[model samples]
Target: MLFELIKLGVDAFSSWNSNRSEIKKIKLENKKELVQLDHELKVAKAQSQIRMAEQDQAQTYNLDMQTTIDMAKTYKDEFILIIFYIPMIMAFIGYQDEVLKAFKSLDLMPDWYILIIVLLAVSISGMRGLFKQALELIGSKFNLKGK
Candidate 1:
């Protein structure tokens, strides 16, 4: 009976050791998983911060552009209008011959030079889409062989 009790005690100790080892291994696996999750969370946070910074930069750029446009709005159009009217005033003031000569001289310039002037005028006038339409019209007219 004593031998049987000794054998039972030994079996119990063996079972306990095995269970303890299994628990330790499970705890190690859990620790590794937690470390991986921590790394992923840090990476996600960094990416989010980067995106927020980019958005802030974009907003600042847009605000600056809006402010500049607003400031220019006060005098840009008026100045352009007055400059354009100067030619008309000169024509009315008995300088029609000079104005005609100036325009005729411009006709002698290169097509590219004329295109540049037109583009500059269109941009200053804030005439969006007109440049493209003008190009298309000019292209179509030039392409016509007879009609």
Candidate 2:
């Protein structure tokens, strides 16, 4: 009877040991899966943050571009008024004749003076057009808000 009891005890202990080992293996697998899940979550969170930052940067850049476009348009309008309207007003008021006569009395050659005037007018007009084109190019490149 004593021998039988000893054998039963040994068998029970072996079975318990086997169950404990299986439990340990299951727990290890769960821990590994949990770690993997945690890592994936961290990566997802980081990607989201990066996307948010990029979006914010894009918004800031767009705002800056819009502001630049607005400023350029304002400057263009003001310059146009100064360059064309002011001259028109002076001519309408009959000040152009006096001004031309005063400049003519300076003993300058008529041909050279005319050439100089033509050149200056052409240059000013060309520069104004070029500035407008440059502003348009910049607006297009930067996605600026403008008409």
Candidate 3:
């Protein structure tokens, strides 16, 4: 009877040890999984932040570009006005024939070149609205907003 009791006690101790070891293993696996999940969450958050930052940078760049264009608009207008005024000033000073000849010489240019020059002049003079109204088909595709 004593030997049987000893065997029973031994079996119980063995079972307890085995259960403890299994519990420890399960706890370790759970901890590893929790750590991996935490890492993934952090990485996802970081990637989201990066995307937001990129969008912010793009917006800033676009604003800066627009500001630069706005700042140059006045200078561009003045420069083009001065160019147009030169011929008139010369004509007033008795250079009408030369001015006429120069204008006639422009006719020698290709039609495409003349068209481009005309468009440039109209655009620079801020006459886009009038041009758009006059040419509905072209205006539909042209995105020039005159101020």
Candidate 4:
């Protein structure tokens, strides 16, 4: 579009100044009309640029808002999973003695070794989420909200 406008200017200048006697220079009234049209074109171009900027700003803001919403939803899901994992880990700890005895009665290995294996299983299953929740909680307290 800008190219077309530049071409129009070039064509107007060349047509009026070409070495053709039949084509005369613009009269005073025609010159005034031409100047008014040029002013109107400039105003129109500025208005177009302003509208484009407004649209681009709105698009960027909308995308930022959407990304925020998606992140919030993901955090909420993680929070719910944390809620579930904490109690399960606590229950395993609370029954540790009884669980060890049961393992002792059934095992072909030492009871302490069986206890270590069970603890490892329980910790592996849920400790990752415990650490994640702890870090997030600390981050929230410190005002380290991520973008």
Top candidate on lDDT is: 3
Each prediction's whole-model lDDT (CA): 0.80, 0.71, 0.80, 0.67
lDDT of 1 by residue, 1-147 (tens): 999999999999999999999999999999999999999999999999999988966765665556458647577667768877887899999999998998899899999999887666666665534555576688798995346
As a whole number from 0 to 100, the lDDT of residue 88 in candidate 1 is 88
Ranking by lDDT: 3, 1, 2, 4
List model 2 lDDT by residue over 1-147, tens digit each: 999999999999999999999999999999999999999999999999999988966765665556556655456445645765665577779899865675567457678876675555544333434444566799999989565
Compared with the true structure, what per-residue lDDT tens digits does model 3 show for residues 14-111?
A: 99999999999999999999999999999999999999988966765665556457746468767878888999999999999999999899878899
Q: What lDDT score goes with residue 21 in model 1?
A: 100
Show the lowest summed lDDT stretch of 10 residues, model 2. Answer: 122-131
- lDDT value, residue 106 of candidate 1: 86
TM-score of 2: 0.47
How much lDDT does candidate 1 score? Answer: 0.80
Clashing pairs in 4: none
TM-score of model 4 vs. true structure: 0.34
Clashes of 3: 0
Off by over 4 Å in 2: 75-147
- Which structure among the candidates has the greatest TM-score? 1
